[model samples]
Target: MGEFLRMRRSQLQLADVGLRDFGERRRVPGLRRDELAQLAGVGLSYYTRLEQGLSLNASAEVLDALARALDLDEVERAHLHDLARASRRTGTRRRPAPERAGETTKQLLAAFGDAPAIVLGRRSDVLAWTRTGHALFAGHLDPHIPDQPDQRPNTARLVFLDAHTRDLYVEDWPKKARDVVGKLRLAAGQHPDDPRLAALIGELTMKSPEFASMWSEHRVRKWDLATYRMHHPVVGRMQLNLQTLNVPQEEGQRIVVVTAEAGTGSAAALRLLAQAGTSSGAGSARQAARTARRP
Candidate 1:
């Protein structure tokens, strides 16, 4: 919480909050702790303690006032509450049970059919995907890899470390990368004790300098819907709309469906890709049957 507050504070200026400097040399950027405390109707020392992590028992009213003073949006306010709740917890950190796509989730994926869709866990792990989802998003990887927990693809890892994924976004790769980092930031605040999540963050920080830099910025974002321009090696270029739907039954699981406008070239490309995926799947099944019969 202290880190988050400090980062937000640094982003503001006197002019932003109706304060004027009298040409005094100020060492710190943005509003000072005293200024912010005054704005939030709290004592300077009390606000300082909160920002220093010395006070963890702040009430919701206080948090809301501080959030308002900082000009946080709805998602940012929710994230602040999440961080506060996490800090108030006691006892040892517990590892959450591994997340999986339930039967209902699988059915939902099947319902999407040739439309590209994937199920993602809290940490953005690929739990399951439709055939065309695999084809459109990661045709270079093994189609069955998501079935193996140990080999599952993490979207965050792919965006930062995988060369193919970097090329997948024909433009706005940085925006996509920032979105991944921001979501991970929100996840980290919500699940501060999840060891696997901590490990994933550590690995990315060490492996990718860009990831490390963005992670340090302390940005938080929630994915809803977005459009991306993509260039697939097999299907060519496409402008696809991505929508994320949360699975209420399975906490932290979300269904991401990608689509292209009807009658557009991108939609036609998606159909061609789906057909190729179907043909390849059938050919593989035939090869497997032949091998079994020979043996």
Candidate 2:
């Protein structure tokens, strides 16, 4: 709660990006605390207390008005609203993790040929993957094992907790973590009834001190344009562009496709991955035939 208030303050600062974004280049003093108070239709001292999170009981109407007064963009406005909701449950009991992506979804991942694809559950759990995808993106471990209620290798958990994450990402690891937290924050707003999201928040707050500390900051990130520099063992270094595909056929699922620019070493690396995948597919086909004959 203390952190979320501070985050709201940052959003307020962003409203005057010209001055508050950086102090050195400011000509005007930007909005004085009183000016913001006027915009929010609240007292100067009252707004100040709210910004400080001195009270955990801001009404939905006040929050809505404050967001409008601050000129919060859609994303920030939503985040401010979410913090208000979270404050409502400071002492309440929470629920269980939600249903994850299913087997048909996993089969789709397997069919993507050389493309490295991993299906993630809401909290960014790596639910399923293609053998080639695993070989490309996360070659160090097996994917058949399900995440324990607490031990799930969620991208957020892994980025913060796993040492291997640092090696896997070339740059922008912090940005990615921020994106994870930001997206999760947004999800929390949409599914206020979801106990699993609460559990994820609780687990993250407890397990990773960095996450706990960052969660306090309340920074919200919109990942509409998320792209990463993917590092694959077989593909060497491929600049894979990421496109998040929403398939309504699979509820609570998003398929991420990783593609490289054509005619580069990455393309050749992709070919090698596809060839390796073909061999595995062949072996599986033979095994299935043998099992059918056994009956």
Candidate 3:
């Protein structure tokens, strides 16, 4: 929370909030603590304690006022509340049980047929995926890998650590990376007590300088719908729209469905890729059966 407040404060200018420079030659970039306190209609010392992490008992009214003063949007305000709520929890952190896609989710994936669809846990772990989803997203990986809970591929890790994922987004790779980081920030705020999440963050921060740099910005976002241009090793270049659907029964589980508009070249490319994925899956099944018979 302190880091978030400090970063947001540094982004504001004197003219942004109706404050004059007065030629005083300020040392800091944005509004001072006292200035922000005045803007939020709170006591300077109280606000200072809040910003310095000395006070976690701030009321919702006060947080709302601060959010308003900071010109926070809906998502930012929600994230602020999440952070505050997390700060108030007191207990030993527990490692959460591994997440899985339920039966209904699996059935939904099957219903999607040739469409590329993947079920993701709160930490962006690939809980389950259709055959086309595997081909479209991580075809180089073993298609059955998600069956092992301990070895599920994490989207954030793939984006930052895997070369194939980096190459997948041929255009606006940085934008996609930022989107992943932003969603992870929101997840961290929501599950501050999850040890696995903490480890993931630490691993990314230690391994990828770009992840470390973007994570420090404290950007928060929820992925709903977005379009991207991708270069697939097998399918070549195509533009696809990613739609994220939240599971009502399971909290923090989402299904991402990939699609392309009808009659477009990208749509035709997706059809071709789907056919290839089906053929590959069939061949893998046949090979497995042959090996089983030999054994």
Task: Report the Cα RMSD per candidate.
Answer: 6.4, 8.2, 6.4
Ranking of all predicted structures according to TM-score, beginning with the best and ending with the worst: 1, 3, 2
Displacement of residue 275 (Cα, Å) in model 3 is 1.6
Task: Write down the lDDT that model 3 would get.
Answer: 0.86
Candidate 3 weakest lDDT stretch, 10 residues:
284-293
Give lDDT per model, in order.
Answer: 0.88, 0.64, 0.86
The best candidate in terms of TM-score: 1
**Candidate 1 deviant stretches above 4 angstroms:** 278-295
- Candidate 1: worst-modelled 10 consecutive residues by lDDT: 284-293
lDDT of 2 by residue, 151-190 (tens): 4466776677767675566576776778888877777765
Whole-model alpha-carbon lDDT for candidate 2: 0.64
Clashes of 2: 0
Ranked by TM-score, the better of candidates 1 and 3 is: 1
**Model 3: residues >4 Å from true position, as ranges?**
92-95, 278-295
Candidate 1 residue-wise lDDT, 28-146, digit = tens: 98889999999899999999999899999999999999999998999999999999999899987677888899999999899998999999999999999998899888877888988
List TM-scores for all candidates, in order: 0.92, 0.70, 0.92
Top model number, lDDT: 1
